[model samples]
Target chain A: MKIKKNIPLIDQHDKNGFWGKFGGNFIPETLKKPVEDLTILFEKLRKDKKFIQERDYYFKNWLGSPTRFIKLENLTDHLDGAQIWTKVVSDLNGGAHKSLNATVHCLLAKRAGKKYIVGDTGAGYAGKMLSMAAKKFGLKCKIFMGAKDIKRQKPNCDAMRANNAEIVPVYTGSQTLVDAVSECMRYWVSNCDTTAMCVGSTVGPNIFVKICGWSTSQISKELLIQIKDEFGEIPKKLKLINCVGGGSSSFGFWNEFMHYNKKQVEFIGVEAGGPKNSKKHAAPLTYGSKIGVLHGAMQYVNQDAEGQIEETESISAGLDYPGVSPLHCFLKDTKRARYTAATDEEALNAYQLVTKFESLNPSLEPSHAFAEAIKIAPKLSKDTVLCINSCGDALKDRDILKKRLGK
Target chain B: MTVSPISLAFKKCKKEKRPALLTYTVAGDNTKKKSLEILNSISKYVDICELGFPHNTPIGDGGQIQTASYRAIKNGIKMKDIFQIVNKFKNRKNSKPLILMGYYNMICRYGENKFLNKCKQVGVNGLIVVDLPWPDNKKFAKKCKKKSVTFVQLLSPTTSKKRIKKIINDSHDMIYYISMLSTTGGKLKISPKKILENYNSIKKINKSKNIVIGFGITIKTINSLKKADGLVVGSAICNEISKSINNRQNPVTNVTNIVSLLKKRIS
Candidate 1:
């Protein structure tokens, strides 16, 4: 269903935490001041010229900015449709694009005079990256992880422990990323005096989504320049595809382009599709999802008939969440973007295919996008150019892959 | 103004020169019949009853209430079922003022009009939506006024005196003054002297002077909270219910006993 009014989220904040009826500050009264204070400080810092320069310096020198944009010649030829290019986020420090926002938010926390950084994570990559950032920034890091996630991503837990970050396992609700987020909110509410919640996704209250999305938009800025340098001019039909858990990468990757090329570009967001004939997929927006409030934002959620969130299933640990980012919720609502899904088997197959075709081991997170690209690329005309973001490197997922393949 | 049960309860407490016991528990906890029995018996001890609508994700709640919600949901309590439990409580011999307290998502999912219609049909006297406060959602508060369901607003230490009057102007029956800057069941970090200071500041504006303070009001804490019109005892009572459930005893008896004990001490 097309949204009755197609006002973009960034332009439509009536200031009561509304993002086109998708994002809101639906939180407890004790948290009201903290949310508003963060909104005020984040807006000031986002526009500060000195803060921007310092952040740019850290982006280049500390967290590995200007990651490469590469032409996937073999994959493009194999598909034989659109000219395919990829933004290699794997080259960034912490082995994923997650470090960008984590590092930036750590600076925000220090500027706010916060002594500790607290966050929630799904697949463990974000928590590890945030822990490393916290260690470097001279702050204490506390991560809330699901017991289920801790078991699946043991290597990430070890890395977080090595950085001296405390991991608090959540046992409530489904004991997945959704519960981790809820638990982290309770912790943040109790300790909002001395701590800043460096939320993992671009899905939180209004202030959180705004600050995180703007900071992470560096990817699209760099990708824009690289694409311009590759082709003499910006292409008319540039397709930007990225996999989404809570949609940090999709929000970051598509934000700048959507602003710069609103009518000129197509944004494609993919989610983890569980096995066939099962209620396991994590594609709430792609599938039929209702608008409800969870973890401080009103967005699309895979809730039961009685408005209770349901546990989602996926082979990829990162994408196994019931809710998506509110911006994606807005995009899906307003027809500003296309939403799709890829099954676990298909994502795994894409992981292997890309490993062989590009000699780059891709995480199952972005492999969902690659999986969809393979389907859509074969049908697109030759002049169209598609950009896929390799947001996660598959190095940490070796054990899961080995077990799934039974190799 | 029509005499709403919430206003009546506060009026009675003020005339009697004692704080009212406002007890809270989720409807349909364990079972529909048993929860109704507990609520009816609980009405005899407390001056007002806060009925919680059990939700899947109670983000503002601590562990004890979350566990109560889990049991209530497990017992097949829907939004509609909560009303059935409320009607059962209202139909009892000694019916107390009933306020439905819950997160906003469930009501937003139920839609505002449909939920208010259900509240009116079930004779719900007041509402304490833990998430929606006074600043932006006055439209919702207006709708509740049309239906005569008191849209209870919250005042925390974080709220300023200037903002407190505005919130009090929006409030109808009672102002839920959160005693600390934390979720329910957290220890009372603020001294009773400081909490009463904030509570009395609100009485300076609103004529009714009705305020119910909650969050860490134990048997020991109840003595110091008698200056207010009412005190909400939720987590302490829920903790007793959880203990009885774990010990395979009757949760209703345990809850009724603690509420009675707290009411006696406060009086």
Candidate 2:
């Protein structure tokens, strides 16, 4: 069946409504009206030139953007047949792709007249981003994280504390992403009058998705220039691949590429396959799940026939979730993007190969994306310059690497 | 408030001068056959019945309802089985319509149209979707009309006059006014005067439909709402069944005792 292209997701031209299959606000009853209020107030704030000017000042002076992209010369030589390039998102002010988005969200919240910000973070990158942004904006910030994550990503927790952000460690339901998100929603419900829960990924159908989408523009903008300069011609098969760790990076790349339909570039989304064939992975789109809304957004989910969520797991903490970005669901259904998975071992091997050859370490989450590149690279010739997003650095995964692989 | 077609069916079967006894049991709480026997025995006394479809996360539900839902789900109560339970009740001599009350997540997962069609095929008289926002879905009401099923709407004291009018206008089934803002069980203090006033107001707006009060309706409260079309009691009776569980054995005697006691309240 031929799936329709460019599904109507956004409300107005600037609004981010739905992406191919994923993205919508699927929130609990208590947070519904408050989210609507935030949406309207945010629209009003987004237009204020003063807010934009203040945000630009902070981005340039506080969170430095235009972070230089490093060419992986050593890795390209080792790969032999492939011209490999990885975006050094860690060079950004907050040291991850999250800063690019979280700062935007914090500024948006300030413009919306919100006094405080509440958010859930699994990898702790987004929490740090929100904390720093909140500090610059002179607003309070609260971050909910998994208890296990609190111990694993202590550096981020400390950074958030340094920014004077409130840290809440949640221990419910595997003590992971699901629980932190639940706690964040609870906090939003209680403090909706004073705060806006800024989601870091394109997970929810809120301003956070738009913020993340905008942040990811760096990848597309940089790639557009780099590809043109290196190839001396606009490349043909411009396949955009990204790790689906709540889909922020994928959205960043896809948002820029989705408009180029005639390019006919296949957008590939890679989710973690923790232990392939085992029930320990976060492949919600591939497995049969219901198309109900969550986190105040409508999309496909790993819900039972009755629409209750089924628990999902993975080796990478950030990718281990029972849900996906709703727009991804739409994309998958409409065939705009093909959603697939790679095993834990494959990602680990790819992660090591990138670090050993390129002399650049990447977060385990993006290694899943690399794994996909490795699979597709063997099929293409030297002409193929597959752009796989390197979402974060290996510093975040040092402990994870030690536990999974001996030093 | 005068009873509407759906609640009137429940009120018709209710014994006069007796509290309307409603059985609270999971569709497949124990084994399917065992649950069926419990339903058959309880059906003899109760005026209206509620069959809960179990789920993994029964949020907003207290311990008793949660346990009941777990047992039913564990015993394999698929959405298809709910229709069979209602069908069995339809085959019985009862005049009340078998009502299925559950969360919206379950309905969404099950495909709303498919579930409604199954409900109609099984001869279910009414449905209480806990998640369906009231009056906002006229299309859903139209679907219920086609199936001859009453789409139940909840009206709490928090419901304003404007909201109530919208609910009454949109509702295909009788109005189900929650006694309190809390979950289905617990010792809640509900004002009879408030219920009477809500009921009176609903009647004034549309005397065509029945207005039953649920969430918290004990014998005392039921008597107080004598002007009410009927009383809908649940978690309390399920709590009673839960107390009698000794070594996972079916608490048939407890179910019988609760029904008799509830019937005696009106008598």
Candidate 3:
């Protein structure tokens, strides 16, 4: 790792709201006016004092801000590599880092003076948090979930519905997260004036990239403070790793760190590798995919020769997306971060290991990170450090796994 | 940019003092032969013919068009099949301007240059990629221009004034103005007076002053859209095809008759 005394200045988004040619507003004329309006409004409201105070209130008071950053003694001892720490992201409401932005977006919609909110969820955390936050903020919530996801992540879907959200069952386009999100985007465009689209990831076009990035940056900011207090100072050989779907956690975890002058950390993003039985995987970055435009943002997309996005397969429904967030693409391309994948077997075994060893159940999404941690930690020196932002609870996969095992 | 066959049709319509009739149908909807025969019949009556290549997900589409796409996909309509349909339509009598309109991903999958070359080879005069909004890789449109195929853009009521000013002077002959926020078969709740007010404002900015309106347009609705340069019939015609197919009749005859009726109403 090249240790630079001067911190690498990471531009979250350029003047056109691009993360180095990764993000932009590439939508129809019907959506152009509203997206541009959102672009202008986000730039103004994100810096406003009242808007900042309002979202911060929800984060600290309701969503449980300042998640615990604890050095894992058990995992650290097992690997005997570096001092490993886990940023416990489930210490908040709705059980993940999803609440970080979901809460903020509810306040944003309230400030913009809209009534109805619509969004699609891959893992159900975003849907749950948005429904919960919108309910608390006195706003209407509607969620779109894929039919397959609705069956697998049924508990999460019921949770959102319990919060008085209208759960729309999407049976189109592979019946997965990608289809649900695409339908939601078209619905938003048709009803942009009356409804606000709550994005579940840091992907999407401009203005949205900025909005999601600013809200989730709190993860890195809190990690900075906790590390300073625990280690006395930041270490030179620290590796930051997290799993990427639409990359909310990784994007949030790395934002503030890039602003530091002494930038020597290696950031790695773990993508979902398919089950051992199948060659179909969702790791677009690892596969060296084509750079194409989808979801209004240009980034790495898992597509066929005819430019149609391919149907991705993964054990974890949340991680089974064909396109990655533009920020992750930009980061990987610039070598600011690296990316790898863990097979479904590896992640499943890692989840069981964490639950038994630490008596803690982690979601299948972040279980990929756990697998990477064990693999990377053993290769590093014991004096070095490894950190994982542990963000999901695997209760959703437990039932399916048990049924598969005939429990 | 080359003056496309579409532009020539518009010029002829301008002399006749009537709005040019633009008709649409999804290529390979049901079967290649059946859909091409429908296209052949539709071309004789309409000034501009838009042949849509079905996509897996049609975002701007309504229920009728989506069902049409599903039927086409079920009938095994691929990108190559769409061009094959156009090739057959190219030799028809009074075929008028043929525009290959569909989602951007289909063209991208076909390879932008490869797709444009295919369009040129099949005598496609223009293109209207539904999701490839302005500034979304103008590179594809530029490639189309190089092949002497006009890449038409959409300017809706929701389009910003800034964008209108930017695209009005482009060499494309006409712009598609989606009349409502609703999909193709959505109710005619769009106020004609409001559409004209917005249409005239958009026209005021354009040097060509060519604005064709579509979305929820039927024969009854054509008179309301008389102020526009041209009238586009998409879902209404697709509905006729669906109804004819449902009644165990040849959709080609039903669709062509509807096109003639729509052309009569506008003229």
Candidate 4:
């Protein structure tokens, strides 16, 4: 694998929040000023020394930064092909990579003199993480979640309640993540003066996508160094795999490696394929979905011929969204990142295989990625390094796993 | 350029020395025939009628309008049905100008050119896309202008003085001023006086533009906001339709009576 020179980095977006015509601020008039103010404040804070120090302190001391990057020796030996490594983001506080963005947003809220923080969640990890961060920062917290997700991710909902965050049930269309986001945005419209909306993923309007991506990019920032330190240099024929819901964890995992030559380091995003025979899956990119706007950004959306958003189904509550991130859409069009889908049965099989082989329990969201890695790992050369971001723990998924796996 | 029907309606209201009454209802709320009958009944009292395209996910709407949309969508309302409603309402005698209100996804799916052509053919005088705001709506607004359809722009209390100027300059014939920072059907968070003050500040940017205040203008609050060029009552009308359906009464007659009362208050 030869390294190429002068390749433009995919990390930067234009001032209007567009990543190759994918993102823009399409919010209602009631939120224009508030979104503008947030963007201005975030831009200033990202450059301020004191603000950076405060955010880093929380990332390192409170939420546990630089989570481990280790090889899955047993799984690699069993595959007998590429060596598999994982960035154990599930080991972080709040038990997922969601805390990174939540901590940054809570800090942003405090810096802006806001007394309350609001957020939306799908799998409940984001809501729980925001609740934990808000408690640490002494700000009032409210989380809007789809009524369906409330039932699916009950343990995390209980954890959010234990943290004293008020949970608002969204019973609108599909009763899922997309509705939760819409409800949260409506709530933010009225409460913008006193509250800051902490968007859970790299979706939403331009500012939110930028903010979430900026905060979570720390994953690749650390992984870049960890690779050099572990193997003496960046490995040739490296492949990175991560699951895409609203594409937060995967974007963070692949951010630093995006500038590398596409031939040397490949990026793969796995989407939820739902049931084996069901047509209702959450793989918008894999299904060749049309470009449409939802939740304030233009992206690949699962919509009907009449442009109405279609309902999506997935065993993992987080990945069951009708739209993907704008950045992922850009990557897909540019042929920078390859995307595929893993069925519910495959993810469940991967979950079992990981637990049995490595004594590790990964959340159902990343099990999609592991399923994809398992398929292609055996076909790759033994010298290739395949890194997967185990983004969350399966503790919150006990109920679903129990019913599905009967274990 | 020929004056849009929306502009002509505003001029007529100015001559009458009263704020123009604008009523909103879902296109196929309850049923297509009843929804059209309701429109025909209410058109006699209102200057502009806004018919909503029922969306499964209406983010900017509150409980009342969301319920109205759900009822319409559940009854199998389609895009063609909304256009047919507009066409039938326009064919009626002494019909008011109709404005189609919906999210942008519908337009994207229908193809912008084809959607605009359909609106032109159906006699849709104006459009108010809830999600497509300034800069983003520039292209679509121009497309509407080419089709002789007024593309209504929206302003809110949160709009900065600088942005107000830009939006008003690009506005077609009318601008919607959200009286408060909330979704449709919310309780008025700010005083009518404060909202007027904000409205006046925006009005000063371009006095010629027809600015209507919406988002929480009920019968109780309509009289107080009657000094503006126009007043839009959406959720209140939607609430009336819901109540009429629950009571097993004629929704068209009940909705007409409410709009008549609202018009009398402003007049």
Candidate 5:
């Protein structure tokens, strides 16, 4: 298999990890050396032929890459406007696109001679994938999860435990993803010598964002080819939509298509808006949050005037975060992508509609993207093709769906 | 350049042949008044006073300091109230040099120039933003220098020699050496001898800078690290306050007593 040679948009960050003044390494002094080492090692590994071959082998064999890109014909007929399609990343092993990053990082940790892999999770998909990957790579895994999230995401927790990963319950502020990341960083500070932190999303310091983005960019690398194979040419007017919690899947899905003209290819990112009538949504980018540092990266953050990070509310635990990925912040500022929010009610409605029309279940995170796509599909012409990234399956969200949707 | 109050305190400690005893307590740990009382009482034995601004999320801190910050923020401690405490501390006679330490988001939210000006107005001699390390802090440190506020640079065991030279070269009158690879208040992971060894390597880069060792500096470990220019005890003090609050004792007396004991041990 020949490796493609194209400069990815994710590699445009400066030496300090700033993507036009969005991301930087705003970490503690103890993490400086480790982060720098990881950066150097990642730069070398990404360019190494052997490393690429190893990563590609796993992408092909383990994760079932080039995940099905199928047109949602029934859903498109129901909407009666644009041709709706989906990159079914939900079909990947571990049931989410997170496996791609987790596989890459676990491999990197193995090459770096690390004995332990540590990570934090909000929705538990990342944690489950990391645990599975760590088990595959024969490394010890410890996952830090918020106590509240542990209750809601019990199945994923059980999955992680089944994979022999230790779950460290974080009882700090808000008992959510933000605090979990903070605690994970604190734990990494003490154990960095023997541990590699597989940050869940593109929301951490420069190296993490770069690593996650690079690993997940395989999504678009496949989608670009699938698009040509299906349509015999890139569609004249195409819209790619994906949900943005920490914006990993969206960045992955949009990275290769970024170089296309904005007129020909439109990028839309949907954020969780919590409840319809409440102001306590996790739509930092859509709500225009100020730039502030959280978990070692400067990004659009939901912070009070006094700079205290505010607690976020969303039905999807994965999207219930106060800060967004710095790369998404950059894309929002540069007008390279249009960002909006889908309230919980709209997302639930999308989940029901997609299940009824297409017989497919998406996690609430990507349900936001489907909600946005459903809303806008009717406004576009029939010739227009809109693709949404179904990044994860809703199996782990059964408790939430049962409670909210009454089974 | 004229000597700053922080430099003067280090000089006094050098004259006495002892490491300057620095005590850190979160501002408004239990309440604004009690926090100020703790500061005032501890200042008698402390060479330099470090007051931390309570944050909702203090990532660099461990469990003890996080509890203290929660208590302070629960009591509705605001930025203005912290500045008021500093102002009141400075109003008293013979008050030691006070340094404000916290995460940088608060300063960024409060406006860098305005926060530094408020520190200057409240007699804050130095500032230590834990998350702001080298290169990222260069501009803010320059701003602090212009305002006569020493922006404390932090050195860790993990910092490379090249980076150490760069940080020490750009350091102000005072530098803080994190004694180990842990958050504030963690148990000392390395022996005092090893910590001093690391400290000496950084001191060799610039002996003129007043360097202090912080993190995991508890009662059992303070005496062994007395050979350094200064030693900072934060988690132990915060733990004492927590104990006093839980036991319904006067935190001021109990905290001051422990600080005095730490000072004696270092001496």
Candidate 6:
């Protein structure tokens, strides 16, 4: 029940092992040796500062890092309740915190001699990002998406198609993110010899978290610099906030901040509160789950007693997963981080408020952050400035906004 | 002392100087009575019996076991019936080990403590769940230990030496090392030399626990594993049952053929 004590990051060369409950190599026996080899190689490469610098170079030059922190002056006034600030993450690539991890995965694949890749995606952003990187690297990419998602998230599907990544629409259970992940897992198990699964987020096994940890590191570094620059001093009691689905954005934002900013800063994660108190939400933090295994690692899952996956609900398709990253579960349990929820109505309101005020349309996922921030911001002193992770561009959700907001 | 099924099986294996033939049939393969017939026929020659509890999807399993699991389920083989078979088997064979093998979902539904209690009540001895690798740390293992039920560790060739050593050290009964790279009914490829070498090496590390080689093991494959303490013949026996049912032949004769052939090698 106690939080697993952290092994010194320096002494640990691989991130492909158990990270609290979140990280481990949950691959088939055939893939174990190769993935282990990849981990060993990646660990050594990651330690070399030059490799990191080169990776950062791509972020700065290609993917556009140091994403803007725009204060939502108008939205704060409109909410008439609490202040809301927008972190612009959508403009990073086509739209997301995905490009940061995608670019690094491609770079690592190139270094590790990985030529082909496969992935499971929920809303198609990560799939698009992976395809984008794969096309650039001249590698074959196959993305598995839920059949329902393929229909609903048409724009993301279009993006993946444009990148020439083969899209396999899975018609399995719930046709959401977790189903796509299961299909991807089966595919990887079958094709372990040639293809590597570019698992997104801090979920899956160690290989996944390590790949994601890079992005989290970048987010932290940027936030540190931005805090110093904007406020003329790093806010002493700032709370770092983001939405946790599979938790790459939150993990990316928190890894550096969690341990280093500990005692100084508190990390808050917002999960999708689908249909409010109904099984329809993806609130892995609150009610939607218990610790169970999915996609190779044991974590929290909204599953039946018989282990059948339950349908997950959320306003954000990306956060509409039945499972949360085990690391997040560990963090939640150990009280290292606090997890809360923002209902669909609240997230939408936050979305509309931010757009009306700041003229920047943020993804519904991040509005969960805005909603949580609204509550937390009021109690903050004038000296206290909280940083909200804006996640992806909400341009794709325009129709949703117009319908919901009567805009 | 209530001996763990694995330890008892190992003692029997050593005394007989033959590999224990462990047959895997879905609890109600064709019918519960028919499945019991196969089990009873094989019991005379086989040393241990592995009853595979069917699930909706057997990810690690191939065609034969999948078919058997499906057939068992088609005939209404609930988790409860698994213990019923074990109880019946106990009336027939007073000493031979009976092991239930499946995934964690089954345990989660049946309830860990409840499952262990049933195993003890039915005089079942051991369990080997595929999805559960960290068996030592799970509540199931602790309950099984408390109930004196042996928790068997399934090992593959790819299992690390550290893991193998830990499993050997942690295991209460015999080690069931899967011989092939694939699941049940997979084609056997390991040469006699390799099997002997692996058996010798594993035996060198842990002499107390019995080492049983399974998965893709045939009569010939089982013969090659003389260095192993026991042979767990699952897919081959299940495949034979499937063939007999499909081709309209005597399953008893096929079961007898495999059981007699394997018993000869170990003996």
Query: Per-residue lDDT for A213-243 in model 1, tens only?
Result: 8767888889988988988778888899999
- Cα deviation of A90, candidate 4, in Å: 0.6
lDDT (10s digit) by residue, model 3, range A1-407: 22233532224555555667677766667887777777677768876898788777778888888888887888788877877788988887788888887887787787778899998898888898889988998899999889988888877888898899998888877788888887888788678888888888887776666677777888998998888898799877778889988888888988878745324677889998888778678899988988776777778988876566778888888888888988788778777788999998888887776766675667889889999988878788887878888887766666666865443
Which runs in model 5 stand beyond 4 Å of their true positions?
A1-7
Cα displacement (Å) at residue B80, model 4? 1.5
Where does candidate 1 chain A have its weakest 10-residue lDDT segment? A1-10
Two-chain DockQ for each candidate model: 0.67, 0.19, 0.54, 0.76, 0.81, 0.18
Q: After superposing candidate 4 on the true structure, give the runs of residues whose Cα lies further than 4 Å from its correct spot.
A: A1-11
Candidate 1's C-alpha runs over 4 A off are A1-11, A259-264
- Fnat of each prediction? 0.60, 0.20, 0.49, 0.71, 0.74, 0.13
Provide the lowest-lDDT 10-residue window in model 3 chain A. A1-10
lDDT minimum window of 10 residues, candidate 6 chain B: B131-140
Please give, for residues A305-366, the per-residue lDDT of candidate 6 as tens digits. Answer: 65545688776788988788777877787787889888999998777666666777678888
In candidate 4 the C-alpha lDDT for residue A112 amounts to 89
Provide the overall lDDT of each model, using Cα atoms, as 2-decimal numbers.
0.85, 0.69, 0.80, 0.91, 0.92, 0.73
Candidate 4, A1-407: lDDT as tens digits:
11223542333566666777688877888888889998889989988999999988988999788899999999999999999999998888999999999999998898889999999999999999999999999999999999999999999999999999999999988899989998999898887889999999999988899889888888999899999999998888899999999999999999888888778889999999999999999999998999988888889999988778899999999999999999899889889899999999999999999988996789999999999999999998999999999999999999999999997
CAPRI-style quality class for the chain A–B interface of candidate 4: medium
Q: Native-vs-model 4 lDDT?
A: 0.91
CAPRI grade of model 5? high
Q: List the residue pairs that clash in candidate 4.
A: none
Reference-based TM-score of each model: 0.97, 0.77, 0.93, 0.97, 0.98, 0.77
Name the candidate, 3 or 4, with the larger DockQ value.
Answer: 4
lDDT of 5 at B248: 98
